[model samples]
Target: MAKKKAVGQRGSWFATVDGIELPCAHRRWAKKNWPHYHDPFKPTENGPSASKILKYVQAIKDEKQVILTNDDEHLDDEGELTGFTRLNYIAIYGVENVSFDPDAGLKFTITKRLVELR
Candidate 1:
């Protein structure tokens, strides 16, 4: 089990959980395949879907049983969320579907799934 980093260190670099480490490879993948606008934190309809996000959330629950709730309800002037992507990076994979294994990453699938749901 990979121990959680002490706040804002390398955790910002890769996705780590239960001592398992999934690094920038995942983030880079999400960036390349995901839509140009899809941001995780401030998840907009333009970004990933609640279902896809739900997958990640489920994964986290499976691994550590942690719960992540949306704290912000306001969008930006242009209508963007606080940052992008919830659960942070290192801890993101725990959210589930953060990676797709082959083509496309979690964000892309989530964004697409969100569109389909809509």
Candidate 2:
């Protein structure tokens, strides 16, 4: 796709996939809405969610299959398996009252969806 860039030595930006991961479209974000596209939400509970869209930018990539996992099993600080599942990341997009959408034609619903640049 976008030349795959130099595969970062690290896969998970947070070092580990223990929580809901919000990637910055890797650095390609600079060309898009940048913070607007990558930072739709501010993380309130942990941070604060975005209130309104300053600007809306169209998507660039074609592949819609997100890096999702049904097994949303997370690990606590002590490395113990937590029962809570962070599979639903729609909140990151400032979406409320959401429900899972498997159809690849819609926006980030309530299910686990990810994107992988090939």
The prediction achieving the highest lDDT against the true structure is 1
- The digit string of per-residue lDDT tens for model 2 on 1-118 reads 1212112123232111234333222222222542222323322344211221211111212222223222244466987544333332221112222222222212332222232322
What TM-score would every model get versus the actual structure? Answer: 0.28, 0.19
How many residue pairs clash in each candidate at the backbone level? 15, 9
Worst 10 residues of 1 by lDDT: 109-118
lDDT of 1 by residue, 1-118 (tens): 4435412233133243446533222333244554321233433456556565556544533453222212223457986443433333332322333333223323323222110000
Ten residues in sequence with the least summed lDDT for candidate 2:
51-60
Error of 1 at 17 (Å): 4.7
Query: Against the correct fold, how does model 1 do in TM-score?
Result: 0.28
Candidate 2 structure lDDT? 0.26
For residue 29, model 1's alpha carbon misses the true position, in angstroms, by 26
Candidate 2 is scored at a TM of: 0.19
